[model samples]
Every structure is written in structure tokens, then in C-alpha cells.
Target: MSEHRQLPAAPPLPDPPPRPKKRQPTQDEITKARLKFLKEMSKHYITNEENIVAKEMFRLHKYNWPQILVVTAGCEGESDFVTFSSDEVLRVDREFNYQCVLARDRVGRIISIPLDFDIKCRVVSHDKASEKQFIANIIESHSLPVTVKFAVPDNHIFDLGESAHRADSFGCMALLKVYDETYLISNPLIDGVLDPHIIIIPLYLEMLISTVVGAEAMSVKEWEEYTEEVKKDAAKLDFSSVKGRKAMAIYPDIPDEAQDTDIYSYIRPDSYVILREKETGRIPKERINYCEIYKCDKDENVYEEITPSVPPRAPQKKPCSSKSAGPPIPKRDKSSTSTKLPPARSDVSDLTVAELGEKLKLLKLDKYVKKFEKEGIDGSILVEMDQLILKKEFHFKEFEAIKLTKFVQSGHIPS
Candidate 1:
């Protein structure tokens, strides 16, 4: 008869390393964390004023970097004030590549962790480039044809509202279009008054706030209902949140239908609605005092109290490659008689983030490709990218698929 005696209980596992207490983030810490985010965005694109912000960010992130070298407009009123409204502040510099919005990912990985992606301008590369020298060179050497990518169908970039500002959502909003100079008029009437008939005024929603006719008084219950309706309508997106505008851009409407193609499918109605200070227009700086960041890597998840200092700086690039001639650019295959090479593989599961980005760029699948980059050095992101590219929503560049497959097999990725 088999005795059903349980073996002695295994020795209790060793206690885990003590977790450091969570603390507030300092102003300096916030700036550095933001700078790291900006640097990541720079890899995909370069926009105006981005250099200046980068310089300022670099200064704050490092103690040794002298403040004298990095300068800004000295006076508050005279200068741009470096508000959320800075112009040409940064550009992504890639074709069909643009910034996507922030939202909680399926892995419980929200952009807010480790740093409030809200204020830091959390941008990442979204698409592949076309007609570039490097891409051309790769195709030429491999006897592969350079294939055109699927262009993101241009939806009319939505207009920005007068109330729209970075502070409204802690700079987490998706970018809308520029409205300053474009909307400005040269009437030369800044200090002068003119005939009301000649004003050419159009009906505007903001005008209602000043209108007596629309301001009819209502009962208390009616007021509550009215306020609720306003809140509801405010959420029904006036635009497709893009790379640069300020709308807290976190709560992007990624409906089930869009679930297949949209990269920001993680955001939903119930996601924690923080940083969205609807009452005050901007998140108070004091909130940084309570900020705590949880950074996870393959080895461990590090939670740090930020007010005193920030988490360790992002991993430095491999030092050995610092001065190496760097990876060789594959030579063009001039021997091939065919003008077109081959297409990227339909199966992208085996590719790394860098490699998958190349495939997306070849096919022009930037946003979906970039959604992974936003996840930061995660292998899981690679899997997510693979599933996305296979869907019908992505327009694959079949012409370049096989060529890309061979090129990737040849082992060369731009450093």
C-alpha cells in the first residue's frame, strides 16, 4: 500500500532583498527623467526647438553640465516661456513616422511608470523611412529591390482648441496641429477698434461663455445634468490624438474595431484618470512630491522614492562599440539583373525590436511598429509588434519582404 505521506515541507524561501520606501520625486529628478524620454524620441525624429529643450534637459539631468552653456530667453514675458506651447520644439524626422498616445498596456505597463509620461513629452518612433540612403544601400548590395511602403492614410489632422494646453493633461495629450501663426491675422488692429460689421465674426463655442442668450439660468438639478453632459461631450474626441498636442492624450479611443490596427489599444474608459486635472487645467507641480516610479527589468522590479533622487540613469550604450568602426553597412548587390529584390517575411515573431522596426519601415507600418518602442527595452513588446503587422490593417510591402528577410538574415542593423 502506498503511504500518502507528504514530504517534509520545503524550507521557506529566503527573504527577498528589502524594498526601498517610495518617496516623492524632486524637480531635478523629474527633469532628468523627462530628458531621457526626449532623447528616446530624438532617435526617430528631430523637430524644432527640440534641440533647445534637449539642451536644457541635459543640463538639468547632469550636475556637471554647466547651466551657463545652455541658455533660454531670459525674461518671462519676452521669451517663449518654454510652455507646453513651444513651436517646432521637436520633430520625428522620419517618413510616415509620427508619435502615438499614452495608455495602459496589457502587461500593466502604463507610460506613467518610473516617470509620469504625462509631463515629459513621451514620444517614440512610429514608422519606417522611405528613399533613404541607408535603406537604398541595403537593397543595392543584397541584389534586392527597394520596395515602397504603405502610406498611413492621411486623416485630416484635427484642429486645436483655445483651451488646449499642455498643463491641462500634464503634457500627456496627443499632438494636434499648429494654430498660432496659422490662425493669426494681419489686421493691424491689435490696439485699435473697428466697425463690428467688418469683423467677419463666425459662431464659436467659446463665444457662448460670454453670451447672455445661452447663459439662461437653470435649476440645481439641471445644472448638474448640464455639467455632466459637458464632461461627456468633452471626451467624445474632437480629433485623432497625434504626436504633439496636449489633450492628456492618454485616453485615446481605441474601440474594439480599432483594436486590431491601432497601437494604443490598451487605453480604455476605466484606466486611472490621473494627471487630468479638469478643474485646474494643469497638474500641480507639488504632485511630483508624491511621485513614485516602478521600473522593471528582466532581473528585478525596482521601486524608488524619487524626491531625493531619481532611479539609475538609463542603461548606457555598450562602451566597446563607442569607438569601433561600427557594424558594416551591407553592400549593394549590383550583380542582380532584377530591379526589385524581395519582400519582408509575413512572420515577424523572430525579429528584435530594431529588426521589426526595419520591417515596418520597409512596409511603412510605423505607428504599430513604434507602439513597441514606447514599451522600452521589453522583449514582450516584440511579440506584440509581430501580431500587429500580420493583421489586415497593416499594409505590407510584399515587394521588399523577401529582400528584408535575406538582409536581416545577413545580420546588419543600424547602430
Candidate 2:
């Protein structure tokens, strides 16, 4: 009643304004996410002058702390940078969190660096743009000096410059060859955008690297020596058993009768020959037969006969099957490396089952080993068959093509 008068009915408590209908956002499509990121980064660097503000923005964007990892691209002769092994780089996510620093180059190779260690770098343009006005703005904002200027001569048409003119193109970077990719980081109209891959190198690091390279320049003499050394190594034959000054000699294995007929048997003094002699100019008169195959050269003190299995002019046998039990292997006569001793099948009588299997492996008849066991051909009978083949005096070639085939099929040597 106190002057209330219904308070004008409280102005009828104005009806609450109709709630605005929530908007269904129209989505923004990103055709090239890489391009978008590159644009944003370029713009950000061009606009932001303060490092603190820029770095804070970087943090807001959830970017990792900057780092550097020097990687070797190709072997020494192929690449311009100092040729180092690629193994120097640690594997990504291999006990360390890291990612590629830049986009792939024209070659589509991207390099990654670890966040655990901080390495300095220099950011220099690949001499892409030369327009003074265009570069002045970039230098003012980003503080990166244009190391190279992309040239378009007056006679050349600008049409061909389109690819190189892209916002993110393969421009030469000072420290690393980075692939040029622009990722879509943010769109005002889109949600759930990816973070941009940003690679920025510091100035000091580039200078440091340049200095180091300048100091390590290769001299002409050093280069020549390296070339000669490589050529020498390329010309020499490589053998495992014959190392250093030691050599392997393959004599003609000529029968005394063939000595006159075979061209290889024509002896020349004062020249190298497989047969040992007192001196290089000397030759055995009539193939002197003795306990030692090497000629007695006590004065010259050349190769001393170490193994009894060797002939004076025998070719050294290479260690077979990548394994050897004792001293040098006993030499066998054959035209090829695949030859194995054809002990009389009866000789297997003395060998155990293990020894028999090993011998079969050396002969490259391993496929028949299990077959022997499957057919219940014990060591004794196996040895007997082997002796029969040996008694026939069939060398490796005859054994492989004829005797071994029958042995594998029938599980016994034919009488």
C-alpha cells in the first residue's frame, strides 16, 4: 500500500528476450595444409618483432624448443658437405623425443633433431628473392639475411618463375637442406588445426659451421694422394688368406709329360713363378721332388713351407663354408672353387656320423644327409658306399654329377 500502486505492475516484468539460436558454424576447408602453415609462419615472423612475444606465441602454439642436428646426406665424393656417416644421427623416438626440423627438400628428404640437446644454427635464405622492397620487409621482421637472390633475367619469361615464387619453395638454407612444405596450422573458421612445422636457425651457428668448413679445406696434394691410394687398392686382387705382402701362387699342376706341351709350363727365370726357388731368377731343373714343396731358398728367405698339404706351386685353398677347425686347409686339385675331397666312401668307415654330415656339407650334398638317416643307412654302410665311390677314383666332378646323384636317390652306391 506504501505508494506501491502495484509499481506499475513492475513494468509487467518485460518478457525475457528470446534466446538467440546457437549458430551452426560453416566449416572452412584447407586444400593445402602445408601451404597454410608456411604462410602463417611467414606472416607471424614478418609481423612479430619482439622475441619474447614471438616465443610466448610459440609456446602458446605448443611448439617444441629449438634444436639442431647435423646430418650427412651422402658419401664423401657425392655430397658437398663434409661426408660423415648417417649413423651419427640418433633414431627418432629412440629414447628421445624429436621431429623433422623442416619440410622435405626437392629430393623429399627431411631431417629431424632431438629436443634433448641444443645445437645452434644460422638462418640464411637460399638466395631466392632479390627485390629490395620485398626483402627489406622480411629482414626487418625476421632478421634473416638473404644469402642468395633468385634471378629472372629480362630476356627470360616470368612464367617459369612461378614454382620458385611460391611462399614455401626449396630455397637454399645455410645449415641444412630442408624440404619446403607449408602445413595448415590455424584457420579462423576451422577447429582442431595442426601445429605448424617451423625450422628457424640462428645466425651464430651458421658462421661457426662456415668457419669450421673453411679450416678443413682439402689440399691438392692430399687429394692426389687419396686418389692414388684408392686406385692402387682398386687394382690389387683381394684375398682373405693372402694378406699383406704374402701372396697365393697357383702352379700349372702340369704332368712332367705335359710340361713341354702346356704353354703355362714354359718357365722364365728373373720373372715370378709359383714354384719356390733359391732366388727369383732360378727354376727347378726337373721339378725337384722333396718333403717340402717350396724350393729351399734359405738365402732369400721367402715364404717358408708351413702346411704339409701344400705343393710347391699349389694355389692356396680359401677357407670353405666360412669356418675352419685347425691350420691351413689341405690343398685339392680342381678347376673350380666348389671342389671337395672324394675320400673313398669306405674312408667314411673311420668317420663318425657327425663327421659324415660335415663332409657331406663340404661336398654341398647337405640335402642328402637327412635322407641318409631316414633310410637307416648307418655310418658303417655309408662309409662303405663312400669307399666304393673312392675305390672307383671318381674326383669331385664325377662324384657330384654321377655318384652323388645315385647315392642320394637309391640311398646306396650301386655295385
Candidate 3:
């Protein structure tokens, strides 16, 4: 019998379908209210480098992977990595598996690549050194030509066991180090730790990883230029000054690490609170009142008293409500076929119990709106009220009041 002959054939691989073009909203498609609200909130950390990471990542990646849902901060232990939305591994071939990549910058190189299945990705740094050095080491190990260095002052002083820095102390800035290679070099530790809560850019780095890194490594010159451009872009940022004065201040009580919940929440939009020894520099999620903020400047501090509930604009005496200002609709004869219209209640304060009930029937507050309504009891009188509790100290009596204030400011409501 002839010996069996086998032909060596290449293994087959699954080709993922072509990705759809990302849907961009037209000017008409955008909800103006939502866009405006987002713009207001983004003013807090828009220029933060870490915060910009998420936007950069999405711009570089997510458009091609529609099924991938990006959650900014993971909710639980299970929330680590770019796991499949369905929580199942997608097999591309025998050696390659679908995975989430975390891309970010350390010193200078755009650290973009998929983490291996065997390796558990994490962030770590010594009490005396910046995390940037550790990240830079990882990049250098990848055969990428990025130089890394850490500066150690004569003595690096950190408040013992706390995240607050000693106010007005150059000792805090001593930990800042410089890292450079043929491709990228500079410092990212400017006064505060580049942690997750203060900056959501790591999420962006995750997105960029799938875009910039591949089988063909980037050239050192290209990498250097890219980092230089990023540095130039950052240099243009002017967050260290408030009205031309330097932002740093020293309060005798503000330790190198402070845990004032109110101050944490307030400064969060501008920078993150890095409580020493805490896993992440995030404020405790519990609802903390504004009074807890111990030491803060007026510009950087957030307090409760600033937000107040608005009252109904001194009951606008409308022409329709004023008896002498308008012609009233003719009253219908009792036996006539025409429908009789109920009279509007212009004076709620002077209304009788029966009349108040009749007027309240016309003012229908929806179930959601009723959540804010308070029924005040002053014996034999029903005082129906609606309020918006803005801060611990501020409460608005009605939505109408809020609207009226804006209207007046914008000239929509006559003074």
C-alpha cells in the first residue's frame, strides 16, 4: 500500500464583518438641552490631560466597535478591562482573542497595546516615586525607545497616611520627575496625582491602544514628534492661575492629605483628591454635605449656600388675571347650550377652602412633579407648594420661579 501523503495547508481564520460607519448626529439630531448641560459640566475638567484621554480614545477606536460599551469607572471588581459586552470571549483565531486594550501616555510614548491574558493589568507606585516612572518602565520593556527618569529631591515630604498635600510647600512638588527617550520625554505629575477620578483619560487610552499599536512598531522619530506635540498642547493649558495670580495657597490646617468630603467634591472638577494609601483617588460616593470642606479658596471651594431654591416670581399680575386689564369672556346663561368656563384663581392667598380645591383641580402636577410638592398645614387651610432642593442650604419653591429668574435675566420676562 502506498504511504499516505498529507499536504501542509494554512489554518483558516474568521474574518469579522466590515464595521459600520459611526452615526454622527446632525445639528437637528442633537438634543439642545442635553448638549447645553454637558457643556456646563465639562467646564470643570475639559482641559485635564487624563480627562481628555477618554475623548482621544473614542476618537481613535470605538467608532469601529459599536458593540463595545465603554463605562468610565467600573462599578465592581468584575468591571476591570475591556471585557465583551456580553461577558464572553470573542475568538478571532487560535492565537488571538478579542480583548480590551488600555492606552495612555507616560513621560512621552503613547502607551497603546492590548494587555496579555496571562498578565493582570494594574497601576502601582512607590510612596516616594511617581507612578509615571513605573508606567514608563513598562513602555521601555516593550522595545519602545522612550526614556524614563524620576527626580528625588533632598527629601520628599508627603503628609503621613493622607492624600492632602502640605499647602504652599515646595516639598510637594519635589516628587515630580522627568522621563525622556528618543521618542517622548517630560513630566505629567504637575502638583496632583493623575488618578482616575480627577481624569477619565485612561478610558481614552484604552480606546487608543487598538488604534496606534500593531505588528509594525512605530519609529522613534515619529514617537518623539507625537509626544512633543502632546507636550506643546499641554503647555498651552493655563490652569495654575486664577485671574493672573498663582493658584497655590497654604492653609495651616490643610495636611498633605486631606479627606474633607465637601472639599473633595468641589475640587474634583478641577483636580482629583489623592488620599494617600487609597486604591483610587476618588471621593467616597456617599452623599457628603457641603459643610465638611475644611480648607479651600473661594475660587476652588464648593459650598452649599450658593445653590438656593427659587420662589414663584412675585405672582406676575398678568393682564388676563387682572379684572380691569382685559375684557372677560361673556358668562353663559344657565339654560343656554354654550359651555360655561370656570373662573381662574388670581388670588390664591385669599381663596376660600372650597375655591382653593376648585383652583387646584386646574393645576395638575404630574406624579414626577408631585415629588417636590409639600403640603403645609396651618389649620383649616391647605397650602400646596412645590420646591427644588438644590443644595443642603438652597431650596426653590417652584419650577416656575426658576424659569422666571432665567426669563428675567434673559429679558424674556418683563421686570
Candidate 4:
């Protein structure tokens, strides 16, 4: 017989309702959220400061404790201000390690979280004998201290037009030479002067834009064209637009000439440009802000409502061990014995960034290596140093490859 009649078709399933789309936040809402976050951060910072002061009072007796002061000086004729106060400023001495941490990381929540900008200063009892002992102990222990002093310039000074142009693109800029002086050039330069003493953290794009606009005026169209030409000149480079969201998309195109050169030619790639402000002579002092920062031990004791603070002293040494010390290991000489330690690794001081990068790539360590190798470092030293400095100084999350590629294209390395 014929197959049984097909079962009644299953009832049609209800069409799934379309998912509701989430509404995007309005600009005002976004701004309000950011402001709220900043306020919360301010509260946290205040709490941290209070806790630090309390601990300092407990650790150092009121009579012998260190005092910290933070000051900011405005341009000439403007009043100086205390931006922030802290007694435990040196408690975060470990934060100094953050400098190395930041070099390798993308902008993180730490930077996004606003903080009160304050310069930290400490008063120390400058005893030559005590200070000498302290420094010697730190050096012997290979520890970086929080209480070193350097002579800063009597006052911060800058050429108005030049400083303004330097800051025009970045809202603020600083020039710190090998000597201790640091010149700060700040926002909205009028007649080439910083109008205020407040340390304003410029917006991110503001910095980039400042860098771009401060340079010679070139149309966006011109930039695109120039980029195209640069790509053509760097034959080894392939053109590609940076992926994902960014304020600006960097188009990497290598020209033909650049391609023929070895990839290790550039150690420090130049990512931004600077242009001199056209000026016949220096602007008058009236147009610029000149200020000076005093040299202060960041870990000295000073008068405070809380207990006094003591200078960081050397660790007291323990008495000599009662048990006999182990016998010293004799040094080996290859001339007299067949067994010899492996030859010392090559010094990395002379290796260019590109060359080190190539070795890193060969070793499949590119993921950990950065593109900005010291121009004089040696590749062997990198492997020998166990890539400590490289890992600490140059690791980039998303842009590691980009930085390496850019370095190759820049051709700034020695032959």
C-alpha cells in the first residue's frame, strides 16, 4: 500500500522577535560619565594621601619625621599654588618602576583615571656622612633610591616663539637636558607665554594634533599624497591602513628604495615631526613664563601636623656570622685547564634597533621585543641580558609589529 499520509505539518514556529537595539550614549551623557569617574578618582587619591600621612606619622616620631610639600609656580606675576599635599609621597617609591611599565603598555585604565597633578618635594637633614653612607649602601645593593638630589637650573626659561610652536600641537611640552633643568611650555600660548600655573593634562588627540599642526602647515590631502610617495620609495614595505578605531589611521607604505635596504637599518624610528616657528629674533620675557623649581630631597623630614618623618637610612648590617664561611671558589683559566666557561656574549651596546629586531624575529621572540632598539646596542648582548631591558622598555601590545615595520621603513639606523 502507499505510504501513510504525512503527519500534519508542525505548526509554524513563532518568528523570533527582533532583538531591541541598544541606544548609543549621547555626547552629554558620555561627558558626564567621564566627569563622575574623575571625581571618584579624586576621592581615592585623597584617601590614599591620608593613609600615607598616617603611616608616616607612626613610622617616624613627630620630632624626626620627613615633611613633603608640592608646589606649582605660575608664569611671572602669577601666584604660586599648592596643588596637592602628601606626607606619604615617598611611600609609592615603587611607582618609579611604572616608567618602565608604561613604555611597553598601551594606554591603560591608570592613565584614563584622572589624578591630581602635583610635584613632590621632601625636606631631608643634609648630613654628609649619613647621606654618603646611604648612597653607598643603595649602590652596593643595586637598589634605586627615592632620595637622590640633582641641581636644577636656577629658573625655567624658554624662547617664546619656539616654545609656543613646540607646545602648539601638544598643548604642553618639556625639554629636559642631561643637566637637571626642565623647561615646561604650556597651553594656549598668547604672545608666547604660559598664562597659568595649573598643570593641565592635555587631551590625547590634542597632543597628536599639536604635533601635527605645530609642524609646517601641510594639507591633509598633501599628507596623503606624501604618504603615498613615501610608500613608493619604501619598496620593501606593503601599504596597509591601521585597523580598528583610532583618532588617526597611519598608512604604512614602503618605497622601492627602502625595500632594497636591510630591515635592520633603523633603530629609532621617527613617528612625529617638528617645525620651527618663523621668528627673526627672540620674543621678550614678558611674552613667556619663567619659573624655577628648587632642589629638595623627596624623602626628608619637615614640619607637619602629623608625626615627623625620618630620612631613609641605610639598612643596619648584622654582626659577622659565627659559623665559618664557605671556601671561596677558585677562578678558572682556559690556558691551564681544558674546561672553560663559555666566551662572554657579544656586547649589545653597538647594535642598531633594526639589527636587534632581526635577531629577535629569527629567534621567534618578536612578540616580546620592541622596534625601538638602542642604536648602539649589540644583538648578542640582548640575548645575553636575557632581553631584560628590551622586554621592560619596548614591549607594545598591538603596535609591536607596526613599530618594527616603521623602524625598517625609516632607514635611520647606521649602515
Worst 10 residues of 3 by lDDT: 87-96
Error of 4 at 145 (Å): 38
Q: Please, what are the lDDT tens digits per residue for candidate 4 over residues 388-413?
A: 23334454321222223323334222
Off by over 4 Å in 4: 1-10, 26-28, 46-287, 290-415
Candidate 4: C-alpha lDDT = 0.24
lDDT of 1 by residue, 213-243 (tens): 1112444575345335433433443322222
TM-score of 4: 0.17
What are the lDDT scores of the predictions, listed in order? 0.27, 0.27, 0.25, 0.24
List the candidates ranked by TM-score, beginning with the highest: 4, 3, 2, 1
lDDT of 2 by residue, 86-140 (tens): 2122111001111212112233222121111122222344433434332223334
lDDT by residue for model 3 (1-415), tens? 8998898898888798999999988776575654454334323221212222233434443334311122233221111221112111111100111121223223211122222212112233343433433333444344333232323231221121112232212111211222211100112222111111111122212221122211122355743453354345445554232111001112222343772322311121111121111122222233111101222211222111111121111222221110111122243344532212223223434555444344333432122233233433211232222222221113322233333223222323333
After superposing all C-alphas onto the true structure, candidate 2 shows an RMSD in angstroms of: 32.5
Q: Candidate 2, residue 346: CA error in Å?
A: 14
lDDT of 1: 0.27
C-alpha lDDT (0 to 100) for residue 269 of candidate 2 = 14
RMSD of each: 31.1, 32.5, 26.5, 28.0
